[model samples]
Target: MANFTELINKHIIVIGGGAAGFFAAINAAEMHPGIKVTILEKSNKLLAKVRISGGGRCNVTNHCFEINELVKNYPRGSKELKQVFSRFNVSDTIAWFKKRGVDLKTEPDNRMFPDADSSETIIDCFMYQVKKNNIAIKLNEEVLNIIRNPKPETQNPKLEVQTTRESYSADAVICSSGGHNNAKNYNFIQKTGHTISELIPSLFTINLPGNNIKELMGLSVQNATVRVEKTKHQYTGPVLITHWGLSGPAVLKLSAFAAKDFFDRDYNANILINWTGDLNSELVSSELTSWMKEKSLIVNTPLYEIPKRLWAFLVDKADIPDNKPWNELSKKHLNKLAQVLTNDSYNMKGKTTFKEEFVTSGGVNLKEIDFKTMQSKIMPNLYFCGEVLDVDGITGGFNFQNAWSTAFVAASSV
Candidate 1:
């Protein structure tokens, strides 16, 4: 109770009620007992992304532990996050939630979600922790501007925050408003003397409208290597054929790693897919030769691990007769089939957001913030975290882990 008296006058304002905002607010309150921490959310909802992430399962973080390897998952902020993650990595995230009575389980792909398999489990934990910490929440209180006292010689240099409804002053300020595609949404942050990086949508599904692959909708390949033609970018994993275009882990990774490229290309690009996951032309020719020696109907015998329906589709695309047997399949026809199987190409005209978890590839320039403390270099006592910091990761739990790491660091400094 004595310590409470020391922090009675300390006020901290955290803007945004998303994962990072709540994490910062709760951690700050818990760390500085009796300190007044208030969360100002622009929207009426709290943890909206948390509720819709992983299809309502809330992907908390990845299972990676090594700081070096963990940082690689982020397309941006890899160098900066290395040291930051070393302080609060994946192991720490799991322990943090476990300490709050929320157990998380890792999937085969390393995505960590609550054991209850519902986002509500994680949400309830955050809400409970915030309540226990006595954190103040102001819904619909959108922050319009942040005015920090210019004169340090002044007695009390409190940061002034203008909201949609009223105004508030704080000893420290945290901007965790998440990411935005439009640059205009960052006007408030810019007003605080920070330059924003160019924002572009990432982790989106490719749009191949009117393509023949749409007929293969619902067909999924276990392992396919997709490469954007003329670029060094490529990804290997499961690829899902959708009514609109291609999706799944591989496509999403490609989307994230090549977000800027896709934006620059106007989403118009040709993607080459190795359907069999064995791109070696020699191996593919050898496999075709082995299939030809089988003394069975070529159409009846599906080659490799590709699904029968897709195999038939490829064969048809290769113009091979359905009634032909192995011996009847001419050299040209066999080569065509092999080429079609190993080198399928499609055009991507656009992209669609991957569910409700739309992450932007840009935010406040990393140079403007001290990663060690998440404090702005230009403005004292001003901190930034989450997607608003130009740090985004590929599909999985990497992005949320960034939020947790940055938010914890910022809150600890406060």
Candidate 2:
């Protein structure tokens, strides 16, 4: 009962089997039932990153609804996505998943995940839709080259994609090749007259070598202010002390916004951390004075919300001796304790990738793509989506949200 001729009339090929490619292929096939849809993945596995994202929970998107505020999370393509998100934003993403029977819940920090709290839920949903829509999937088919049809005067332009195993020609092509650091990987896209941006690592952790803070490997401060010395970059949130260095939301965000700066510094710089969220030196001085007067043992009672173990460590580092009474404390010791408590500096020797969520800060230039339709401004019938474009966001599910919004818009237009 299948119409063979109708299936051959129109063909759409989507590159990459990740979240963006899957979404685009499924949505395009569902919208145009008569058109033939196929997804070609170079690897055998599909959605491998999705399986590991959010520790297998599959962070779908963010809870943010305001269009203006949502664009601020992206370090690159903020201006371009401001318009792209206007078409299919976070609310639309939530609804799209909900309509497919995958309920999503938002965390206190606004990361949205499936109600079932399993990435398998999202994978199963996409697979079921693909099967129902009759979308073709081919794995391990690495694309070697792409040749665009030369007939500019023709009504419809065609393209040919050559893979290691076979060749496929399509009426339209969607490039979601992913964020690869190797420039050679973009040779095929470059053939289409698109320029590649300089790629840099973003959303990574700083490596603090020879620092004794590593002793407190698991200690985390709920609210700490981190500032890159001699720069206008700063962030305040949770900070965690890892075995090698610092890893947490605050540090990750700072690294993302200042990725290029960190790269320029060769990862060698000084980072100042305010252990106390409030950086008021006067208030800290007064509070410590009050604690000294009320408490008999200065070393026994740890002031503020700082942990006792960390407070003791810091006090010792400040040359304060054990069993030192408040009244017996020297003026110099009090000043040193107050200085160490508020202004702690560390040296960053290098950086480590932030877990499996390694995001690159550059890709295909944004100016070459039409934001209105996600189509190539220079080449017709060619589209792009996901990290393949020059767009990346910080942690906390913002990058996934960008993938959803851009993929949906591209598919709808295709």
Report the number of the highest-lDDT candidate. 1
Model 1 lDDT per residue over 330-363, tens place: 8888888878887788989989988867888899
Against the true structure, candidate 2 reaches a TM-score of 0.93
| lDDT, candidates in the order shown | 0.89, 0.86
**Residue pairs in candidate 2 whose N, alpha carbon or C atoms collide under 3 angstroms:** none
**lDDT by residue for model 2 (238-307), tens:** 9999999999999999999888889899999899887888666567777777766554777777776677
**Alpha-carbon deviation at 220 in model 1, angstroms:** 1.2
Stretches of candidate 2 exceeding 4 Å from the true structure: 1-8, 328-331
For each candidate in turn, the TM-score is 0.94, 0.93
Candidate 1 is scored at a TM of 0.94
* lDDT for residue 318 in candidate 1, whole number 0-100: 87
